[model samples]
Target chain A: MEDALLQAFLFAQETAEEDEGSLIDVVPGLMVWTFVTFLIVFWVLRRFAFGRIQGLIDQRRDRIREALDEADKARSEARELRDRIAQERQQAKMEREQILEDSRRQAQRQLEQGRERADADLRERLEKNREELDAENARLREQIRRDVVELTLLASEKVTGKVLDEDDQRRLIEETIEEVDVKRLASEN
Target chain B: MSPLLAAAESDFDPQHEFLLEEWIPLHLGPLDLSVNKAVVYIWLGGIATILLGIWLMRFGLSLRPDRRQTTGEAVYDLVQSQIAESSIPTKALHIWFPYVASLFLFIWVLNIIGFVPLPISNDTFDLFGVELPTLGIYAATANLSVTLALALITFFATHVEGIRYNGPTRYFKSWIPEGAPKPLLGLIVPLEVISQFMRLISLSVRLFANMLAGHMLILVMLGLIFIFSAWWLVPFSIGFGTVIYLFEVGIVVTIQAFVFALLSGIYIGGAIEPEH
Candidate 1:
């Protein structure tokens, strides 16, 4: 294999100088075509192909940024709504407690007023009953005293066999009232 | 008839494939600027590259991408991020990204096309009183002049960018390391100058040799069956040739194009910023 390679190399070395169109020979035409072709390919592809691709990449990037911004906006709005809900819940709880407190205070005031009114009515009824009983007691006492005086005068007339005059009757009633306590009699009856 | 028999029947000189036979002879002053196989292959490569680029990237491009568009985008991204972004500086990327990407696709297509057997050869043989053209394999990139021309473009672009960014005095001086001793200056300057020229040779020769070597190996393998003209040698010839072909197609073809573009980027980028 080494000898084969060496021979090929030697043969190439031998032919390279003699052959103007050898494998290693620098052909000017081929070089110019390569340069021209390469330049043209570079220009055409860059103008059309890569340019559009870069544009797509930029577009996709912008879309991704927009999506992220929208997501952030949505998240913030949701947070704000949640905070509002929490605040409302707290306020509602305070309002409910305040109403309950006010109801309890009103109920207490009404209960105290009702109790005072009932006591005042009971006291007035007691005072009126006492005054009526005192007036009746006085009237009964007067009737009983008058009946006793009349009986005393009739008994004196029958026993003494004489008719009493108005002065004698009055004198006899006074003497009987002094001897008999009418207040004690009325209390006993 | 078997492919081996046909190859054996012909006077198959492995080296003859690289030889450029002019189809139309055109002379300008003293130079023989003839239309030859290499020139034709270059034109084919250029045309195919353009067609591929247009079909994939230009036509039917939407916000919604298809398979072809996806592939094209992948290639573009690879070239931009991996090659141009890494090697070329950001400031000059707009100008040179297209240049480097075009160079990559152009050379890659040429290399791939070289492996394809095309009916464009002067070599012919008599078969049943009918002459038929031989289907041969050749690459424009295999030629020294072609690769040199490409390297020369990079070589000039590098220096041009360097000079453009930094003045000629500073750019040339950048080739020499900063704070070197005065006594070593004499040796350093010449070595640096030689190295600059060496970049041209290295870039060109690397591509030329890899392509030439792969093609030469396959040719020699095919040539073996013809030289021996034995039925038993057929299997070995076809087997080795197939392996080499596959290897070249899979690895060497893409690698050479990538390295060329990568090196071109490196050279141009290094020139733009000497400190970098």
Candidate 2:
């Protein structure tokens, strides 16, 4: 029985003698080797792969922030442009109203001057007509006096063959008209 | 001779009673890699976890998460908060969570596999020319390969986190903290460098030792049931086996998984926060 147990122990350790050898040679020290390998691999991976990925992530974050800032700037600029356009439109509208008001005032002034000139022309025509009527009335009165004097002289010539003076003609005309009216009335009675 | 050595050998090998070779070939390939049965079960458990995780993620996701998704999310958050963020930075933690969670769940499922009943017996099967041992991959934690793979992953993650936290020059300096009294650094630096390399072995061995010891104990206990001829001995041994099996289901699997995850966290934490 001791031999069998011894045999088992030998079997466990035998592969170490082979030239190509099994891992058993290092088996006793396996723990030490494993520990060392693990640490070295851990260190190498940490330095190369992990560090690079982290940098990439940080860079991506910064890019996103910059994009957001650009978007904000664009929005603000658009709003400012809209406000400026609104201000310009309002100023233009006010200027248009001022021009319209000025045009109305100019037309009103021209109309007033045209009306004043027509009124002056009407007043001058009325004064000239009044003078022409006065003149015509004096000429008709003279013609009537000349015809009455001539008629009185022709009547005198036919009756007594004599002509009257100018002053006497005037005074005789007034007296004959009054004497005629009294004689006509006495004959009718 | 020691009494213990005598008892260890004379004992009619419980493993020998069953004609393991008559039923199946022990050596599998040119390397004569003995297919550890538990190793196969470990692979099955890992595959099951991956398939289930994918199915749940694919069909169960909702804008307003359903109950399944809610449960998954809760567990995920728990792992993230308790294990991941505590060790790694919040910035880098999300990137590492998937790999960490995969390792955790994979080991967990593998460890618990022994408790789960297999539809097919592990008994040897007839092959093309000869009988072949049951081909199965046990909980990877039970085998050296799976544990080594996990350690390698941890090893890679640590370095990655270290680099992210500190550039190469600063990272190497982290092996020895800032204020070690310049003269003492020469002595301490070699020790620090040696310890740094030891982390991989430590990581693998911790899980491997716990899992290997537990499986060997269970195997011995179950193998004992087959050794005795008395009918009464069968009942007693079976009862004890059942209890041990149940404990494995409840405690061993969870504890081993936690240990692996905890160690991973520690390794990553040390790398990122060298100040600690």
Ten contiguous residues with the weakest lDDT in model 2 chain B: B14-23
For model 1 the local lDDT of residue A99 reads 89
Fnat for model 2?
0.00
Per-residue accuracy of model 1 over A112-184 as CA lDDT, tens digit each: 8888888888888888888887777787788779888878988999988899999999899999998988888
Top-DockQ candidate index: 1
After superposition, which runs of candidate 2 have C-alpha atoms over 4 Å from their true positions? A1-189, B1-43, B63-67, B117-137, B227-229
The best candidate by TM-score is: 1
Instruction: Estimate, for each residue in B49-101, the C-alpha lDDT of model 2 and write its tens digit.
Output: 65544544434354455776555555555555677767665666646655555
lDDT of 2: 0.57
User: Can you write out model 1's per-residue Cα lDDT over B236-274, one digit (the tens) per residue?
Assistant: 999999998999999999999999999999999999998
Give the clashing pairs for model 1. none
TM-score of each: 0.83, 0.50
